[model samples]
Every structure is written in C-alpha cells, then in structure tokens.
Target: MTAPDSSAPLGVFDSGVGGLTVVRALRELLPDESIIYLGDTARVPYGSKSPDTIRRFSVEDTQFLVGHGVKAVIVACNTATAHALPLLQSTFRVPVIGVLEPGVEATLSDPNCERVGIIGTAGTIRSSAYQYALAMRKPGLQIHAIPTPLLVPFVEEGWTDHPALESVLHEYLTPLLDKGVDTLVLGCTHYPLLVPLLKKMLGDQLRLVDSASTCAAHVKTLLEAQNLLRLPGEKPTLDIYLTDLAEQAEALAKRFLGSTFNKVKKATL
Candidate 1:
C-alpha cells in the first residue's frame, strides 16, 4: 500500500479514557496533527482480562480506527500493548506503536538509571513486558516490576492524595526502593496522573519515566522521518469514541486533554 496521506489522522486507543494522556502528549509534540481516540470504556480495565480477550478488543479498536482512515495506530493501554502489539503490527499496514517500548527506552536513556523499577497493573506486571524489553536493551539490567493494581481505581476516583493512596504507594514501592532502584517507569498510562503524589512520596530525587510523553516523542520522530507530519498552523481536529459511557469519557478527557473535547460520541468496539 502507498504511504498514508500526510493529512490522515493518527489513531489512538486504550481500554478507557486513560489513553487521553497519550493524546495529550501527542498534541504537545505534534500540534498540527489530527487525532482519533477510541476508549473501550465498557471494558475499562483490560489489565484483569485474559490475553485472548485483550487481543480481540485491541484488534476491534484498531479496525475501528482504520475504518476512520487513520494513518497510524497507537496502543495507549499498557496491558493491551503488552498482549497485542505484535499481532497489531503484523496485521496492519500503518505503523503500530505501543507505550511499553518507549517507556523502557526513556528509562534507559538516563545515565543515572542503573537499577530501574516499574509499576503497573497486575496483568502488565505479569506479562513481564517491561522486564523483557529492558533486558533486550541492556542484558543483565537490574529491573524490578511491581503490580500496584489499586492505583488505577484510585486515580479513576480522583483520589491522588488520600491517606490510603500514600499508604498503598509506600507498600508497593518500598521493595523497589530497598532494592536501590533510581528510576521508576510508570508502566500504565493512567499512572502518570499520579506523578506529583508519587514524587512527593518517593522523593524528588527518584527519576520517573512517563511512557505517554516518550511514546508521543517516538511518534513525532517517525512522522518526521517518513514525511508524514501534518503541516503547522493547521487547526488540528480531534474525534473521540467510547464503547460505553461517552459522558464519563468526556468528563475524564478534560483532565487529560487540558480542555473540553470538540467531538465525543459513543461507539462500539
């Protein structure tokens, strides 16, 4: 197939509104580009689902975006990317980018990050995607990944600074801290929302790798190299779809996009 038109909108998907964090980064780095984001709100927590189910939902999300003539796809959900990125790349024509590799790359890019740590949902940590990716980049790399499953729901409830949140974070991060990890990878896109609190609890001295920003940077580089970047000064468009609860997704999108969405509608898979 011919290379996608420079004006084609880039596609992005997540199990839910958490993916908007990625869209936030993309807009910052590539302000002229159009974007279509799909949130599978009906299946919000892909982290707990089986790999087969996650893969199925991911394909449906990708196909839905492809139907909208997206030039490339971003698997913004760490769990979905961990389970289905390979299949999506092999089956799709456009570039398929996942949040995982970019985060790993960002973590290793820092020279002071010798003992790297990662925190994610149960499924993401169980997949060992970050560990494997880090090892591939640096054999014998000291890595620690812990599943802080509670953090997701906490963020959804807007409970960032609650006493309970601090307790849970300490419980989840103490082991990695003890292991002398100097850097932490926010493996789940949703985790970035808790950064200020995380830094407060873990101390400013610890470096944090935000996968969403790194993934967006990677997308910018790819678009530039392929000459697929949209021209500057164009008023970029954003169309968002959610499998369920469009209102909820719309409400949450404001937090991620830093503004109200221009178009938000309910759509299936």
Candidate 2:
C-alpha cells in the first residue's frame, strides 16, 4: 500500500543506463518505494569527463530530478559519485547517496582483504577516486588502478561475451594482475555484466566488489535513519528518464527492477 500522503519518488541518476543495476537492486529490496531514474544518455559515458564537467552534469541531473518531487537521490554513476557526491549532498535538501563511500566501507570492513585494485574509465582512474576512498578508510592500503575503457562500450552494445570482449578484458586487466591486487572493485555500474569474463581471467583468488549492492545496503540504512523508509503494500512504481530516449532502457528496465516498467519518461538535463 502507498504510504498515506507520500509526496515524492526516490530519484536515481547515472551518466547512462549502466546505473540501472543499482535501480534493479533498489526495486527488489524496497518494492514499495517509488523511483525516478534519469539517464544522461545523450552523454552516455561521464567516465572520460573532467571532475568539473562531471559535477556540473551531476548538478543539472539532480536539479531535474528534484523538480520532479524526489524524496532522495542516488548518484548511481561512479564518475559522478567520485566527483559530485559532496556537492550533491550539500546542495540538495533530501538525502543523497553515492556509490563510492559504501563500496569503500564494505571493502575496508572485510578483514580478509589486503590489497585492492580498481577498474574504471579513464576519468575515474585519473581521479584516483577508489584509491583515495580505500586509503582514507584503511591507511597504507595497497592500491592499483586500470582504466578499462572498452568494457563500457561492450556493455553499451550489450555484448558481455564475444571473442572481442575477452581480448579487451585480458588487455585491460594485465596491469592490475601485475600489481598483484587481491580485490578488484568493479568501479563502473556496467561492470557487473562483465563479472563472468573477469572471473575467468582473474580466477577465484581475486574478489570482485559489486559496488551497486553495497550502495543499496547503504541506502536502506540511510533511509531508515532518516525516517524515509517506504512502507510495503503494492510493488513500487519506478519511472525512468533519459536525455536521449532509447528502446534499450525500456528493455533493460525489467532485468533491473524485477518487474515490467510501463513508463520511461524522456527528459533533457
């Protein structure tokens, strides 16, 4: 049942549809919460942009969602989380969560882990975002970074497995393996789709961190603490928005949300 007088939906934004993985987790875990997801599809990959550019894009995205009566916003893009999380939290009135902090928290809390590696787009690798977060939590942490640009494109094309995909993963992961890191953080939301290929390459010894799931757990806690938890009744209504409307977003919605989505509202921000 809808919460009496509930006035807004939960807002989520990513540079593109990759963040739908986070949306999928949210819908399965909190079925009653309404969600408004905005994908900056026109500028699909924020991973190569400068921090200034990412922050500006994130701010514009947040403003668009906030205008639509969002109770909270999730910065589902890793690049945005790295660059714009603090800005979003301070600028917005409602609770704002990002994928970075939660992933860092989870990795640090795992006592079995020693050295950690991060694979992301060039921008994320250049920012040293994951390295800094991990270091901040556990001082003297060994960190390695590999900028895996091709993985994002493969994900965009929905090609998780192809002869080309394996070639790309091998080429990208070579440096991280040389660094001998034990835990690999799937820094891009789209990266979850590549877990099987990554596992085959890295073997069972190296753990791949699913930042989206960690972020979802964090959202659950943050909402509860703020008295914003959605009460259960019927399934949640999730609305997807994209700067460039695409059939792909609509097709992928069910995989992420665990239910068929009828509405994918288009937007430009």
Top-lDDT structure, candidate number: 1
**Candidate 2 residue pairs that clash:** 1-233, 1-234, 24-256
Clashing pairs in 1: none
lDDT of 2 by residue, 53-85 (tens): 899999999999988888888999888988999
Off by over 4 Å in 1: none
Q: Over the stretch 1-269, how does candidate 1's per-residue lDDT look in tens digits?
A: 78788899999999988889999999888889999999898887898899999999999999999989999999999999999999999999998999998888888897666898899989999999999999988887899888988998888777878999999999998899899988989999888888889878777758999889999999998998889998877689999888887555666777766777776888865
**Clash counts for the predictions, in order:** 0, 3
Model 2 misplacement above 4 A: 1-7, 247-249, 252-259
Candidate 2 similarity to native, TM-score: 0.91
Per-prediction TM-score: 0.96, 0.91
